[model samples]
Target: MAKVTLPAAADTSAATVKVWDPVVRLFHWTIVTGVVLNLWVFEHGKYAHRLTGYVVVAALATRLVWGIVGTRHARFSDFFPTPRRVITHVYALWRGEDARQLGHSALGALMMLALMAVLTGLGLTGWMMGLDAFWGVKWVEDLHGLLANSVMALAILHVAAAVIESVRHGENLPWAMITGRKRALGAHDADIAD
Candidate 1:
């Protein structure tokens, strides 16, 4: 393992660092609730369902804006999953290197971006389904269903990846999102400045 020092709040103690802000956590759980309610709990096209969808759309919009001007780790620039970054992450994993990241890993970042895009698709198609011209349009309805399914699938993968990475890095990642704290940076770990 290579020794590395990160630019962020790197510490040698066994303490946790704040990563996800409250806004980020709220957005995450709000989406989780909205997606669950819209997909499973509420009836399709009902007032509750549509209202939940709109809430989800609002949350997504808020997150998109927050990504531009949020806290250090909340900003997209911290982990945008560029092609080169993803490739390097994958290659390190292939070589059995420690690819643990202080913020989102490259693959995790890709998954987050993908899920957001699919959620946006769902929001757009859902809205179109309510419009005058697109009302009861088969294509819009189909696309909405497809996007919903994509989000569910991606969300499952995201959860599983978080669990696995948490185990690999000796920390509970899902809980970290809730508490907004993660273990301090260590050797062989990549922080935001990495």
Candidate 2:
């Protein structure tokens, strides 16, 4: 039998590299669907709404565990933003520098963290509302609404940032999240090992 040959990279300007793993991608979309359902489809304080919230909570819990044991880019250690790094990244963007990170950028990582935290808080408050002791409590219900609104605002900002970064770096970031791959690195691109 003839040996199978792999395709040459010379035909393309950049190679394709795996960035997000399947688990990460699944979790990302699952959370998105859950949030959308909770926000627009399901009636608030209903069983379906609460169920979707629980599903989102489960997705978040899995993501937290994955961050501990997942692939390089998926791990928290790889992209957890420090203040200095975030500052530097912001400065680079302000200067119109091409800081093409293979994984989530510093600001992106911070946004991810914030989104997850807000989601967790929403889940908690939602659960509290279900408890008999807290049922019909105005403050608990208000906090839940606040968290829900926060999630929506943060999600909008996240999408806007992704679009801006995609244009700046010449990569389709949202597509990358769906496909689990990104354009390969060029000389000026920042290396993020997976």
Candidate 3:
């Protein structure tokens, strides 16, 4: 894992630091748009729907590569939530600890990975539905529907968690993703080095 650098704690200016790079921001918004379009805007099996799926898959593929070689916070290693970390974070949350992470929180990291996996599964099943070998295959269609529903449910939970964390940590996480920066590390936050 790369070193995670944190800002000085004495700084009370509420400054922001760069975290998500342009590639990461683009990938995030692209997925969000694609999900919203496919879920509520575009009709299923329509040209727009398939095109959006392909676009989202392409973004996912790019993200997979970026996760290995992207900027500090964007790299998966920066916040890959191990089981121990997840448990620690959960315990802290249960105890109402601040536990504000400068980058992705452990639970946030897990949610990200889960969303990606569900999206990949959805894309695969959607692609399969278009193949001749799977024509009239109820299972393929059913699986696709299930994955879509899962994505929606997960998305809702993701937003709710973001809101909860924002309240607890005094930072707008969704805005951070858009702005590609976050409030600098505070004294209470666990310090790290780059």
Candidate 4:
């Protein structure tokens, strides 16, 4: 595995390498599993479907908690894009000059926000659907389907972005997310610098 070494906080002569915390990696894989299982079980197994929905809700809740109290990179503040910065990023992308980031970029952050919104909506609607008054209500059922489809679409875009970034940077971004390691940056990363 490749390791990145930066100037140590205590001593410039020594390099202090930082790595993602375990909670960050756990949340990532758990969400991936939860999303896949939710989709698959919903299609093929009724009981499993509901069970997986609960799992997804749990995972989402965990992610929200981690975002507030976890490591630096895991925090929402670390990756949430500011309006001005997001606009600048979009302009840079149009100019083909966007920088590589250690965490999610502006567009990536937007996608994440969308995905989280959809997931939250789905979870709430699913819960409501379970109530006696709301059970089998056509609008609630349709909203759930709509949110599910949005999640599917966002998943596709997420994968595509990862693939494109990997190809562009000659690094396995998905693997980096899984393993929580990345190669040290170069001068280009310094220049474009997110």
Q: Which candidate has the highest TM-score of all? A: 2
Tell me the alpha-carbon RMSD of every candidate.
7.0, 4.7, 8.1, 6.6
Question: What tens digits encode model 1's per-residue C-alpha lDDT throughout 129-188?
Answer: 889999999999999888888998999998898888878778899898899988888776
Candidate 2 ranges with C-alpha deviation above 4 Å: 1-12, 192-194
Error of 3 at 192 (Å): 6.4
lDDT (10s digit) by residue, model 3, range 1-194? 99999985766537788888999999999999999988764555578898999999999999999999988888899888888788888888789874566778788888999999999999999899889999779999999999999999999999999898888778898999899988877678764222
Top of the candidates by lDDT: 2
Model 2: per-residue Cα lDDT over 39-100, one tens digit each: 76555558889889889999999999999999999999999898877888888777877468
lDDT value, residue 25 of candidate 4: 79
Candidate 4, residues 40-92, lDDT tens digits: the string is: 77879868877777877887888889889888777888878788768988998
TM-score order of candidates, best first?
A: 2, 3, 1, 4
Instruction: Provide the clash count, candidate 4.
Output: 0
Q: List TM-score per model, in order.
A: 0.89, 0.90, 0.90, 0.85
Q: List candidate 1 stretches off by more than 4 Å.
A: 1-13, 192-194
54 in model 3: Cα distance from truth in Å?
0.3
Task: Show model 3 residue runs off by greater than 4 Å.
Answer: 1-13, 191-194
